[model samples]
Target: MEPKNQTSVSEFLLLGLTDDPAQQPLVFSLFLTMYLVTVLGNLFIVLAVSSDSHLHTPMYFFLCNLSLNDICLSTCTVPKMLVNIQTQDQSITYTGCISQVFSVLVFAYLENYLLAVMGYDRYVAICHPLKYTVIMKPHFCILLALVSLLLSTVVALMHSLMLLRLSFCTHLEIPHFFCELAQVLELACSDTLLDNVLVYVAMFILGGVPLSGIIFSYVHIVFSVLRMTSSKGIYKAFSTCGSHLSVVSLFYGTGMGVYISSAVTDSPRTTAVASVMYSVVPPMLNPFIYSLRNRDMKGAVRRLITAITSFL
Candidate 1:
């Protein structure tokens, strides 16, 4: 085999969501709105948590991080997509594509681990109420956050490095709006057996482990709630969990849909659309789900709005 230079492909053509010129305007408008809303909504969560000292608990700390992750996740993809739509250009530079893949992977995995951490927070609060403060202390919470960020960064770095080793052909076109890891791997000319193996190992360790933690945490929570003698206690416990559970369901459900769609259909477009649900929709809706279902969050947001209004 001839030694191909890494610079063989300087750019990749992104096919985007749809090729219809007529629908371009509508698609652009729709995504622009979603992008703005996602940013603003998650921003509010972060601000509300920061402004309100009453919300300075471990739970809200995690929520703030989750919101930040959502903003980053959306930023990693949407701005580029919006730009492509407006300019009627789908080409992404090789460097830009690599950056996108790295950024998205970091945030995506961070969110995954964060969700599990939040579930653990809930479990400690509900199941071990007396020890909640002791177990989820400020320093401890910070440690958890740091660990999540570090692990995610390491894994994302691994994937990006692996992709860098592979070579691409001249006609480098990606069917998705962004440079999804799977799609990029599929386009590679070099042997992808190692990449596939690494991806599966990552799926099992990174994906399976955190998901198991969330499930275990929730199961303990449910049992604790069921054992409660007081109806009010049960209601309060369930209420606290409702938002997190909803966010969890949305994240994993959409993620599973993307995987299933990709496996079931050979259509990259369909998989791309499904990927939107996990990558785009969940982040956009997380703020709403958390704030609406969480009394402390709503109160904090109201206080935040009132303070801003008074200042203005």
Candidate 2:
């Protein structure tokens, strides 16, 4: 049997979280609820930041982008899964799968860069308070966001183009909800040595560098906080960073868990289930983490709600 080029392969079967007929309804309801929460929660964050003049700063600006990215990330995977479950059709067209891979990568990488940028914003505001406005100007903030988006697009394009080169075997069933790049590569019949190498290289450069930046920023922040003589100053510093740190922990912790679980376990299904932690849970929880923990965000949201209600 001749290996077919990716173009010739019309579709791939996605073996979602479970195959149980009885469990489909439960899965559908669970993900539908989660998807709604994730979208609405992130949407509220964006609205709160944009509508409130008080939150028109670097931190909230980065946070607004992060919320948008989270919405995109979840949209890339969950709706398709929901549709698949509801229709009892696991088949995804080749173009659809590739688009999913690219979209997921773009948004996921954007989130990584945005989080690191947010950490740097906090660090500047805390450790170099007088220089915060000068260093993180409005133009610079916009530039940072554009750069993150450009880098994410280029990286995702590279991976997607590489995927286009590979030939796939007949057995094209992916044991996951969405079209994950790694899993798609595994299905390729052609040599994926170069593809695999590129994946790790991109991961290290994209993933490691942002993580390192976040750690470095927070380390400086911690030192600055410790140096504060006033308890009030110390409390203020911690309060400012608490929500971001919690969000970072949730994002990175779940991401690392997915990677570790995938590496340790041989079951693709297990990996799929683990992926929900990073791909679904964090997005749903992030808005709550920020709004509940940060006083400024709470105030902004409250004002936003009041305005909306009064207008209504």
Residues 1-312, model 2: lDDT tens digits: 765655478999999999898999999999999999999999999999998888899999999999999999999999999999999999999999999999999999998999999999999999999999999999999999999999999999999999999889888999999999999999998899999999999999888999999999999999998889999999899998999999999999999999999989999999999999999999999999999999999998999899989999
Model 2 ranges with Cα > 4 A deviation: 1-7
Q: In model 2, what is the error at residue 208, expressed in angstroms?
A: 0.3
CA deviation > 4 Å runs, candidate 1: 1-7
Q: Cα deviation of 178 in candidate 1 (Å)?
A: 0.4
In order, what lDDT does every prediction score?
0.93, 0.94
TM-score per candidate, in order?
Answer: 0.97, 0.97
Among the numbered candidates, top lDDT falls to 2
Tens digit per residue, CA lDDT, model 1, 172-271: 7898989999999988878989888989999899988999999999999999998999999998998899999999999999999899998899998989
Cα deviation of 50 in candidate 1 (Å)? 1.1
